[model samples]
Target: MTSPSGAPGPGGPDPRRPSLAWLLLPGLGLLVLAAISVSLGAGDFSFSGLLAGTASESWTLLVASRVPRTLALLLAGMSLAVAGLIMQMLVRNRYVEPSTAGTTESATLGILCLMLLAPDTPVIGKMLAATAFAMAGTLLFLGILRRVPLRSPFLVPLIGLVLGGVVHAVTTFFAYRHDMLQSLYAWTTGDFSGVLRGRYELLWIGFGLACAAYLAADRYTVAGMGQQFTTNLGLNHRRLTLMGLLIVSAIASVVVVTAGNIPFLGLIVPNAVSLVLGDNMRRSVPWVALLGGSFVLACDVLGRLVHPPYEIPIGTVVGIVGSALFLLLILRRKGANA
Candidate 1:
């Protein structure tokens, strides 16, 4: 019962399908969160001073730090959320995301390998290696899923967790041997404190990939209906799947390279959007992106304010919040089934 446009059919506008007006709510919320993110930081900033042409230092700090950090948050959040949505659609599992599927771990492993083999490799080179590894890891995960007899939705993510654990262990072992454990930890821990004007430009690539995902939303929605269905509709499932893998891998790699991993972000944001908008990718992508940005910004702001000058890493804050919500989603699913 979906229209060609991916909306409800036959029945006048479905209440579950958000009107354009309702869609603006999350957009507005993201804007407000962006404002707060720009305003809050360790450094003293005054809007009035800046407007009145008095706070020269404040303007410098705003441009060099706060603005960049906020932009990074938004880009990383939107990219990860879209990446997760695409992963879930391709895998036909609500529980799977880049983190759970070993994509991030594989990317980190690639970066570690680059550090060992050629420490002088530029940032772009590192990103390429990470993307390559992520794609291979994700394809391996899909291969495993095909071979496994179990098709339970929960089992899919559990398998991914197992794969991610193995990849992470490998990455950790190499990092520990080379005394790069601390460096690895820093790269994997999501934080925005270090973001500055020139440092965060790479994240724009990730944002672009996210935009690309939105453009291919209809194809992904078809692919999500299953390979047989997609083929019957005259679409090449394998090509679409490969394109999605590339998008997911590049987005994950770029975000990890730029801002470290924000776990469960891709997982929860899409699920939240799905609950409201159904599985229609076209309708849900914008909401997912907006909510994702707002969620990360809010978490980052909370981390900054919680300990004053000492800020908690965004990864830690998101892990705590996301894990709790993950459990709640599980419980609610079980309760509904019961």
Candidate 2:
């Protein structure tokens, strides 16, 4: 149940929920990390130089590439984490995420369609197409849940995993037939090296979606409670469900378009925060956003530095970490149930 403040509180306010103090504490750490990230690669980047504005090359890298990349990380992190939270609430299951629930595959199909039909289309048009496919894909997953007898919570994600596999198969088949398989792989492989000024603007849509989520946080929690419950409380539950779908699909498409299948950011970030902070959507969204951004930013920096001058993809690092966490979560879940 929720506390008087509507935050999840079995007894009282969740201590793990960030206050201004908590925000400041991590905010400072993230700031320090972000500074380091911005200054690391191929430029005369230092605090003094940044402040004095003396280095033109440094300033250009800061403004054109590094700054945009960082912003993309922040937006992708925040949006995808919140998207995971929303999917969990909507399904009332902890395991569903854009990656798991066929959302990514659906969005990728949309992207593939755009590539075939209108390679010259603007990015926004591509985003719209992908968002539409993602919405349909997510809806299909939910439809599966509705039609089947799912007795175990674990079954929810298991089905989602299977669903994602099927979707991926389709994406692969079509991409191969079209002889665009290489382009497809590069597009969705989740690297940030290409995120210069002009390439990454689609991520702004994710930022805007994140803000919308914050505004309607309470509605999500209500919708999560189930259909009859929300309806009795005077909400159109279906409408809100569709709204959640739209938001989830929108952010997923935007992130995929701009950042390229940043695997497990959605799955790992929200689940990690939820373990500490509980399921208080209103209170927890900000924490999710902040910590998710910080985590992705750190991973991006690590990717850049691990090979130095050369680089690993941000998705590769996140995939390695997230896959470990995924196994751990499954084991912990089993132990708890046992």
Candidate 3:
């Protein structure tokens, strides 16, 4: 039997113990990557400089660039991954996320509005506008989900993809008409090089919502179980679903404004976690955050080193990796069904 804290007593696996142990692997990964994150960039800096405490530029780089980038990656990765898991649960679809569901695109459009109209809106104002747009987009996506019934699981996400595309096209058309397409392009691709001391602090909101999701984890899972089960359990299904969408929208807006719109991170990380950790949202959510942050940090570092002096965007690297993994997931699902 398992103890109250989930320790295995005699024979079977301890439900919580295994997940706790699995978390350590990512902990070690983050440690190594943390060091690498601070060290690699355009300028030369070393851990020795940090230890010796003599080099002035090293200290400046740590304070000015690497530290901010590392922090941004961690928060953005963790938030997006948790948000992805919540979106999947809320809609009962494994495929739709902030990227695919038009949430980020809507946020981008909002930012465009702020840019064109005010051109001087403060960061907080832009984020507020973007978040409002993102929330609306999420509700619209959920509304579409309810009205349509799909026999095949893939069809739902396919519709989301098309919808997101339409949103993107609209946003792009407006951006072009305003002659701001170049600026909008930057917002759509994920990169951390621009991160600095004051730039990425907004992502802390995403972190806060991630913690909130954990507290409401069981409710989210119950909501995913369906209308009858949720209602029978004396829960407000619509309220819970709304809570989930708000969390997703918050993460999408913050990340898009503070970092950039990263695709497939939400889709890719959760599915991979479920493969190893199983489908218990309460248990697997932490792993989802850890793996997501780790993967993004790893991809960010890879983006820096791949071309040396020149860097590739993290979105490109992540998209390439995520797309390949997505095909594998599709094949695996098909095989299991067969």
lDDT of each: 0.89, 0.82, 0.84
Q: Which of candidates 2 and 3 is the stronger one according to lDDT?
A: 3
Model 3 per-residue lDDT tens digits across residues 34-110: 78988888887988878898889989989988899999999999999999888887777777678878889889988
In candidate 3, which residue pairs clash? none
lDDT per residue as tens, model 1, 1-338: 33232222223334376688888888888889988888887789988899999999999999999899999999999989999999988888778899999999999999999999999999999999999999999999999989997645678888999999999999999999999999899878998889999999988998899999999999998998878988999999999999999999999999889889899999999988877777888888988889999999999999999988889999999999999999998777666556
Compute the lDDT for candidate 3. 0.84
The collision pairs in model 1 are none
Instruction: Quote each prediction's TM-score.
Output: 0.95, 0.92, 0.93
Q: Which stretches of candidate 2 lie over 4 Å from their true place?
A: 1-20
Candidate 2 lDDT, tens digit per residue, 1-338?
A: 33221222334445554467865876787787777777777656665776787877677778898888888888888888888888888888777789889898899999999999999998899899999999999999999989988777778878888998998888999999999998788757888888888888788788788889889989888887778888989999998889888999999999888878877777778777777677778877887888888988888899988878888888899889888888897787667666
On TM-score, the candidate that comes out on top is 1
Best by lDDT: 1
RMSD of 3: 5.1
Query: Model 2 RMSD to the real structure?
Result: 3.3
User: Which pairs of residues collide in model 2?
Assistant: none
RMSD (Cα, Å) for all candidates, in order, is: 3.5, 3.3, 5.1
